[model samples]
Target: MRKFFDPNLAGANLKDRLLACLGALLGIGLTSVISAAFVHPHGAFLLIAAPMGAAAVLVFAVPASPLAQPWPVIGGNTVSALVGVAVRMLVPAPELAAPLAVGAAILVMSLTRSLHPPAGAVALTAIVSGPAVLDAGFAFVLIPIGVNSVILTLCGVLFHRFSGHSYPHRVAGIAPAPINAALQAEDLDKALADLGETLDVSREDLDLLFGRVEYHARHRRKGSTGGFPTGRAA
Candidate 1:
């Protein structure tokens, strides 16, 4: 049981772990407060808790994803909300409108590079929740949904930054993996073909995340095997 609870070297520092946990909690709490304060929705499903839970999962389980970041959380949800409202106004058939709204949300988010996972929830809420959401109208987009996103993102940025993780991570000065560099040098479509793996996430995202993991694993083995005087090297 003790062995199973061992920490990896890259994240072995106790303070860093504590900070990560704190940041995640703050992110969740801030969002929840804002969601409840405004844009008061009826069901527990479309409430702020949903997006906060989704964000918490992203922070802990999938921290490396671009989709997990602050911008994605805010922009993605807002864009989806707007799309939903537009679909409600424009499209006559929701059977057709629902899928289109979601697709439009995805397209806008991806193109704008703010692809948050919970945005799908906003779109789904817009279509399924029916008249309540429509009646709330633009207020739905502005008050609770948009308001919640901003508060959540602000919390995320502050928490991640103070916790020693980068927020709104700058791409500059960071060198991508050799494979990614090579891929980008070529066209994205062709590069994906060459990789020969079916990835659920974007190929570029997958590459960066895998590269980070591999790099950490290598150092973690060194720290555990070589640096730990209490343990014998296996």
Candidate 2:
């Protein structure tokens, strides 16, 4: 137990901790507001979306995940939910809907590049929960789920900025592009093939973001340590 809290390895980042708390609080508050205003009978949206929503906001929004973003977070959950509801309403039986719904959600979310894990729950909820959720029909996907994601993302962006952390931090391994151009799908593929190495983003954008983050993290650590900050590399 004592080992768990060792200062050298387990010390908390004050800024990060504060942002996390604020993110969670804002997520809960926003969900509560939506649920209350809508007069949802079960508030299951609150129960399910709150914790998962908070986590999504913290991990994807504040951190600026390469894989997770506002569009992905919101669209993924909403779209997957729509697919699930479609399965439940269109399919023959509840049990069949459950598994089919999950598969449909995953495939769509992946293709759209909005692969949020919790969207699976959203899908299942639409199917197994019966008339209460079914009564929502297609509206359920847009209302609470979409609204909650947008609100949480906005809050996380503000909180992350306030904490002196970069929201939407760039992935370290990728390289930036040489010019800012919206490449077509074919263009992007050609560019990647030209590079002869895989990257998460265009070569130009990657380079720019990496340089900025690398500088900030190293300088901040230096200031915090009150030394040259040896034995470390950003």
Q: Which candidate ranks first by TM-score, i.e. highest?
A: 1
lDDT of each candidate versus the true structure: 0.65, 0.61
The ten-residue window of minimal lDDT in model 2 covers: 225-234
Top of the candidates by lDDT: 1
Per residue, candidate 1 scores C-alpha lDDT tens digits across 60-168 of: 4345556777778778888888898888778868898889888999999989888877887787678777677777776678756777778777776666655555666
- Error (Å) of candidate 2 at residue 185 is 19
Clashes of 2: 12
Q: Mind giving the per-residue lDDT tens digits that candidate 2 earns over 82-201?
A: 898789889959878899999999999989878776778778878877686677777777656666666666655666666665555543433233222332335545756887974434
lDDT of 2: 0.61
Per-model TM-score versus the true fold: 0.64, 0.63
